[model samples]
Structures are given as structure tokens and as C-alpha cells.
Target: MLRLFAALPLPPEISRPLRKLQKDLVGARWRPEENFHVTLCFFGELRHTQARDLDELLGEIEAPAPTLSLEGAGWFGRREPTAVWARVRESDELRGLASACERAARRLSIPLERRPFTPHVTLAYCHATLLEDARAWTERHQAYSSEPWQAGAFHLYSSQKRDGGPSRYIAEADYPLSGFTAPEGMY
Candidate 1:
């Protein structure tokens, strides 16, 4: 079995600013810069055959890349504060792509969590972080924003855990969107 998800990887231009916001917070395990992404759908653990079928279905999705930006910082778990994240500003195209991911899963007869999609790039996971401390961190970066950038592609990722460390996400497949041109200096 493999843990899989669909997500849009952040370009360097957007990630540079996010890296700056990773300090002065105690009890937070900051995520590595390379792990940052806006998840479209998480399919959790799946059998190898199921994963291959999902990958093929994902490749068949036809949609334009969404233009995205980060607007503000926030935290999940208001009481205990489980994670910190930079909110992704939503657009019609973004929602459509997310919906297409869900539709693909439905066609594969895969069950998904019923939670509504809240797009964000998680900055850290709170480990015994105080509620007050989490609130303060969000307030400090309330005005955080990133310049809009068009995503060239979204990917099917397989996550593997390393002993005593955060999970490493590996892109198993990439599906490029229509009309995307690689920005200069980016591959």
C-alpha cells in the first residue's frame, strides 16, 4: 500500500516568502521548504493496483491550471492548535480542479473524507503548542500574501515516512495543464 494525494507544488517565487515566516514559534515543528503544497485531494493509503488506477484517472483530468496566491496565515484546531498554514486564495478554476480530483475518486469507487476543502500550505505542525501562542503567531503574519502565480501542473504524490522524521513526499506522476509555459529560471 502507498499513501497518495493530488497537490499543486509551489514555485520558488511563492515559497521564498513562506520560508521567512518559520521562526520565533515554540513547540512547532516547521515543515521543510520542499514539502510545501496546496493539496487538492488526499486518498490516504491504497493498494498498488488502486493507486495505479487513480494515477491513470488523474492523468485524464482536463482543466486549465489555476492562478493562485497566498492571502493570510491561520491555524487548525482552535483549542489545541494542531497546525499552522498560509491560506490559499481561492478562484473558480482552483475549485474546478479540486472537484475534478474528487470526481475521479468517485469514479474509482474510493471513499474520501467528507470534510470541505480548505486550501492552504501548512507551515508547521504544533507539538504541545499553546493556544495563546498559536493565536499570536497567526496575528503576527495576518497580512502575509504572495504574488499570484499560475501553476504549470499538479502531481500525484506518494508519501513515505522516515524514522523519527516528517513524511517525504515524492511526485509519482505529473499532469500539466493547458496553456502553461515554464517561467524563466524554473524547470
Candidate 2:
């Protein structure tokens, strides 16, 4: 079985700018630069057959390309935090895309995610003594905001636990948004 989910991969241009903001935050257990991605669905482990069926179901989705923006910083846990994340502004396209993925999951008989989707890229997770300092650091640099970003495609990712920190991810399949296609003769 392989763990999977659809997500928008951040382009280097966006990631680079985010990296700078990440540098300003001190005392938080930061996520590795490579793990920065916006998750669309988190379909836990599935049987091999289910995985193939999921791929087929995902391929049928057709929605307009979505534009997203990262505007602010937020944390998951209040006192002893479990995760830190960058927040995404709500947009119709994004909500529709998320809804579509949920429908697909239901169709495939995959367990539907009960948690409300609050779009954010996790920045860090763990018990750290610098929570207060991290919050202050985040506030000091909260003005950072990038231009609207177009999400042309989303991918099914396989996640695995890593020794040093958060789980690692690998792209298993990619699905393009409506009216967008990969450059001719390329994968």
C-alpha cells in the first residue's frame, strides 16, 4: 500500500521567497525547504488496486486553474504546539478544487476526510522552548506576501517518515487543472 494525496507543488520562485521569511522565524522547529507544498487531499494508505482506481478517478476532474496566495503565519496547537503553518487566503477555485477531490475520494470508497479543510503549508512541528520567541519572530516579519500564484496542476504524493524530522513526500501522479496542459512532449 502507498500513502497518497493530491497537492499543488510550489514553484521555485515562490519557494525561494518563502524561504526568506522562514529564515526570520527563530526558535520554531521549521519544516525543511523541500517539504513546502499545499495539500489538496490526504488519502492515507490504500491497497494497490485502490491506488490505481484513485488515479483513474483523479484524471476525470476538470476545473479551472486556481490562483492562491500565502499571506500570514499561524500555528496549530495553542500552548505546546504540534505544527506551525503559512495560511492561504480563501478563493472559489481553491474551494471547488478541494470539493472535487473529496467527491473523488468518496467515489473511490476511500475514507472521506472529516476534518474541515483549512489550507496551510505546515512550517514546523514538535515541542520547542521557543514558542513565544517564534510567535514574536513571525509577527515581526508578517508583512511578507507574494503575488497571486496560479496552480496549473496537483499531484498524488506518497509520504514516508524520516529519521531527523517530518515525513518525506514523493510525487506518484500529477493531474492538470482544466484548460492547462503540460508543454508538448513533456511529462
Error of 1 at 39 (Å): 0.4
The pairs that clash in candidate 1 are: none
lDDT of 1 at 157: 94
List model 2 lDDT by residue over 130-157, tens digit each: 6676677558656767777788888888
For model 2, the stretches where C-alpha displacement exceeds 4 angstroms are: 23-27, 129-134, 181-187
Q: Model-by-model lDDT, in order? A: 0.93, 0.79
Candidate maximizing TM-score: 1
Tell me how many clashing residue pairs each candidate has. Answer: 0, 0
The alpha-carbon lDDT assigned to residue 52 of candidate 2 equals 93
Number of the top lDDT candidate: 1
Q: Tens digits of per-residue lDDT for model 1 on 1-187? A: 9999999999877987899999978899999999999999999899999999999999999999788999999998967999999999999899999999999999989999998999999999998999999999999999999999999899999999999989999999999998787778765
